[model samples]
Target: MTASSSGALPQPRRFLRLLNFRDSLWLLAPIATLYGIFALIPFALIVRFAFADGGTHFATVLESRILVRVATNTVVISLMTTVVALVLGYILAAGLWRAGPKMQRVMLAFVMLPFWTAVLIKNFAWAALLQDNGLANTILQGLGLTNGPVTLLHNRLAVIIGMVHYVLPYAVFPIYSAMQAIDRKVERAARSLGAGTPSVIWFVILPLTLPGVYSAALLVFVVSVGFFITPVILGSPADMMIANLVNYYVRELVDFNAGAALALMILGAVVPLIVLQQSMGRGGRHGAH
Candidate 1:
C-alpha cells in the first residue's frame, strides 16, 4: 500500500480505540445495574431503617431480653455444629481418601446426598424421626434403653443435629480436597521410619489438613448462624436464634425498623467470620506452595 493510505489507517485505529472504552461500559452495564438494584439498594434501605429515629431501633434491639437469649443461642448452636461437623466430616473425608475407586464413588454419594435433598424436606424428616414415638424413640424403648419414648424433638440437641447434617458436606469437601493434595509417598516415608498408622495420621496427615479443617469450621459456623427453619422445627421457642429473632421482629411485631436492626446485627457478626475465612484461604494457598 501507499504511505498516504498507511497514515490514514492510524486515524481509524485511534477512533476504534476510543469506541472500545464505551463498549466496555456497555458490557458492564447489566452487572452494575443488577448490583445496584439487588445489593446496593437493599443495603442502603437496611442502613436507613436500622438508623431510623436517631438509632432508637438498634437500642431497642440491643436492650431486649429476647435478643440476649437469641444471640447466645445462635453462638452456642453454631459452635456446637462446627465442632460436630468437623469431626464427622474429617472421618468421612479420611475414609474417602483411603477408599478404592469404587468405594470412593459410594462415599462421595453419601457425602453429597444431603446437598441433593431440600433443607425443608430434610428438617421435616428429622422432626418425624426424632419426635416422641418416632423411629428413634421406638428403637430406644424396644431395646430397653428408656422407660418410655424420650423427648428428642423440640430441644437444643435436635437443632444441633439438623445443623450438623446440613453443614457436614461443606466440611467434607474442604478436608477431602486437602487430603487429595497430600502425597501418598509422604505416608509411605513415615511408615518406613517406623511411624504407626495412628502416629502417621496424627503427626503428618492432621497437620497438613489444618487449613481444610479451619476452612470447614468457619464455613459451617457461618452457615449455622443463619439457621432459621431447622431451629424453629427442631427446637423450642426458647431455642430461638438471631435469624428467628429477626423474623419475630418483622412478622410478629410488624417492626420493620427493628427487624432491619437485628438483620444488620447479624451482618455485623457474619462479616468478620467471612473476612477471616477469606484470609485463612489465602494463607492456606501460600503455605501449600
Candidate 2:
C-alpha cells in the first residue's frame, strides 16, 4: 500500500506493539540504571579494590591472626542466636497460630513492633537495659539475686540478646507461615484417635513445623552473621564478628584493600547460603500437607 493511501500507524499503536515481553526490555532501564548507579558500581569498585595488587589483600586478610578468632566468634554467636531464636520463635509462632482473633492481633503487633524501630535504636535500648545499674541489674539486686550490680552488658551473651531481639521477627514469620499451613484436621483426628495433647504435639504438630524451623534457622543465622552495631553496643572487643573485620581493616588499619577483600569474602560466604535458601524455597517452603 502507498504510504499516502494507507497512512502510518499512530504512535500509540506502534508503542503498544513494542510492549511485549521480548521487546519490552526498556521497561527495566530505570531500575537497572538506579541499581548500576547505587549498587553495582559500588560493588564493582569493591571488587576492583579487592583484586588489586596481585590480589594480595586476600592473603593479607587470610594470614592475619585475628581472622580465625573473629570467624570463630562470628560462627559461635550466630549459631547460639539461631538456636535461641528458633526456640522462642516456635513458641511465638505456635501461639500466633492458635490464638483467638483479638489475641492474634495483639501478639502479631508485638511481634512486628521491632520492624518499625531502627537497628541503632534497638541496640542502644538493649545496651541501656543490660548496662551496669540498669533495670536488669536493679531487679537482680532488689530480688537479692546479686550482692552488687552484675555485669550484663559488654559480653557475648549481651550480643546474643541484642541479636535475638533484632532477628526474632524473621524467625517468627517463616515458622508462623509453616504453622498456618498445618492441617488442623490432622490434630483433630489425632485427638479423636485417643491421642493426648503431648502425643498430638509430638507426632503431628512438631513434625509439620520442622520445615519452618529449619528455614528460620538458616535465615536467622545468615542474618546474625552480619551484625555490627549490636556487638559494638552490647559487647566488648572480644565479641567482634566477621563484619567487624571490614571495619577493622578499613577504619582501624586504614587498609581499604583488605577491607574490600574481607567484604568480598563475606559476600562469597553469605551468597551461597542465600542461594541455598532461595533454591529450597523454590522447591517448596514449609509445606505441611
Candidate 3:
C-alpha cells in the first residue's frame, strides 16, 4: 500500500511537469492580468452597482417610458442595419469570390478602406454626404431626380446608412471565408450534372455559405446594438438607442448606479445572442467535418 501511494504521487508530479512544458501559463499572464484589470473589474463593478438597493436602479430604468422607446429604437435600428449590411456584404463577398487575383486585390482594398478609417471619421463623412444639400442631394439634383434638397440627414435612415457602411467589411470577411472553404470540385460536379449557374449557386453555394451569413448577421447585430457615436451624430433625438440611454443616465442624469444597471441590461441582452452564435459556429464546424 505504501509503495502504491508513493508511485501515484510521482505520476502526478510527472504529469504536472509535462503539462508545464506543453502549456505555458506565463505567456498568457500579461494579457490575462490586463483584461482582468480593465474589463473584468469594470464589469464586476457594473454588476455590483446594478443590484444595489435590491435592484431599485433596474426598477427605475424599467419604469421610464423613454427607456422603452429607446429599447425599441435600438432593436429596430439594429435589425435594419443587420439586414442591409448582410445583403450588401453577401453581394460583395460573392464578387470577391468570383474575381481574379488582380480584381480580388482591388475589391479587398475597397472592403478594407472602412476598417482603416476611424469610426468617427467615417460617421462624419456619412453625415456630410447625407445632410440636406450635401453631395448625394447635389448629384440627385444634377440628374434632375429632385428639384430641392431632401430631408436626408438626422434621421433613422441616415443612422442605418452609416451603420451599414461601418459594418459591411465585417460581414464581407466572414462570408468570404465561408466561400473560400467551399470545394471547387463540388461546383464543377454540379455544372457537369447540367446545373445552370443560377441553379448551382442557389442549390450549392448559398447553402454552403449560410453559416457565414448567419455569423455576419449576428456580428452586425451585436455591433449595431453597441453603437454610441453613429446614432448620436446621424440620428435625431427620436432615434435614441440603448447605448445612448446609458449615456444619458450617467452623463446627463448623473446617476451612475442607474447607468450601470442599464449597461448591465444591455450586457444581459447581448450575452445570449453571443452564446447562440458560438453554438451555431460549433455546429457549422461539426457539419463541415
Candidate 4:
C-alpha cells in the first residue's frame, strides 16, 4: 500500500488544538487570571459607575464645548501620528528585509529598543531634546537654520513627534511580518523581465505589501488614540486626547461617573475597531500568499 493510502497524515505546523473541560481547560488558567484581574474587573467597575445617576455624565460630556475640540484634537493628532509612522516604518521595514541576517538582528534590536523602553522615558527624552537650549535647538542654531531656540515642546508637533516615536515599532513589525512572507521568486521574475528597481518595487513589491500596510495603519492609529502620557509631557492643554480627558474627569474633577462614562464611550468606539481589524487581519494572514 502507498504511504498516502495508509491513512497517516503529517501534523500541521500550527493549529487550534481545541480544548476540553477535563483535559485542556487548565491551560487557560494563567491568562484567565491575568485578564480577570487587569481587564475584566476594571471594566466591570467602569460599567457600574457609568450607569450611576442614570448616565447624566454622558450628557455632561456631550454638552461641554471642550468636548468638540478635544475630540477633534484627538482625531487629528492620531491621524497625523499614524500617517508619519506608517511612512517611516515602511522604509525601516524594507531596509530590515534587505539587510543581511546579522545586520537584520542589529537593526531589529534598534527598532525594538523604543518598544521596550517606557513611554514616560521616551517622552522625557524627547522633551529634553526639544526643549529650548536643548540639543535639537543647539544643532539648529549651529547650522544657522534658526536664529534662536524654537518652540518645540508642549505643542501639537511635539505631541506627534513623541507619538510617532512610541508607535513606530508597532507599525514596523506588522509590515515586516507581511514583507517576510512575500515570495522572493515574484521579485526575481519581475527583474528578469527587464524591470528596474523602482519599477519592480512599485509594481510588484508595493502591491504585495498593501495588506501589511493596512494592518500597520490600524495598529498605529489604535495605539495613537490611546496615548495620554505623550500628550501630557510633550503637548499643550489643547492637545489632550480621550484618555487624558478621562484623567481630567477622574483625577482633577474627582468625578468618577463622568470618567467612567467617557471611558466606556472610548471602549465602545475602540472595541468595534479592534474587532473589525482583527477580523480583517485573519483574512490577510499577515499578508501571506
Q: Which number leads on TM-score?
A: 3
Clashes of 2: 0
TM-score of 1: 0.89
- For model 4 the TM-score comes to 0.90
What are the TM-scores, per candidate, against the unseen true structure? 0.89, 0.90, 0.91, 0.90
After superposing candidate 4 on the true structure, give the runs of residues whose Cα lies further than 4 Å from its correct spot.
1-21, 285-289
- How much lDDT does each candidate structure score? 0.90, 0.89, 0.90, 0.88
What is residue 166's positional error in candidate 4, in angstroms?
0.6
Error of 3 at 38 (Å): 1.1
Q: Is candidate 1 or candidate 2 better by TM-score?
A: 2
Clashing pairs in 3: none
Report the error of model 2 at residue 11, Å. Answer: 14
- Residue 36, model 4: lDDT of 95
Please list the residue runs of candidate 1 whose C-alpha ends up more than 4 Å from where it truly belongs after superposition.
1-36
Task: Put down candidate 3 lDDT per residue, 1-289, tens digits, no spaces.
Answer: 2255445465787866866775766578789889999999999998888888988999999998898789999999999999999999999999999999999999999999998999999999998998887899999999999999998989999999999999999889889989999999999999999999999999999999999899888988998899999999999999999999999999999999999999988988999998887787667732665
For residue 10, give model 3's deviation from the true position in Å.
10
Model 4, position 283, has a per-residue lDDT of 84
Q: Cα deviation of 46 in candidate 3 (Å)?
A: 0.8
- The root-mean-square deviation over C-alpha atoms between each candidate and the true structure, in angstroms, is 5.7, 4.9, 4.6, 8.2
lDDT for position 130 in model 1: 98
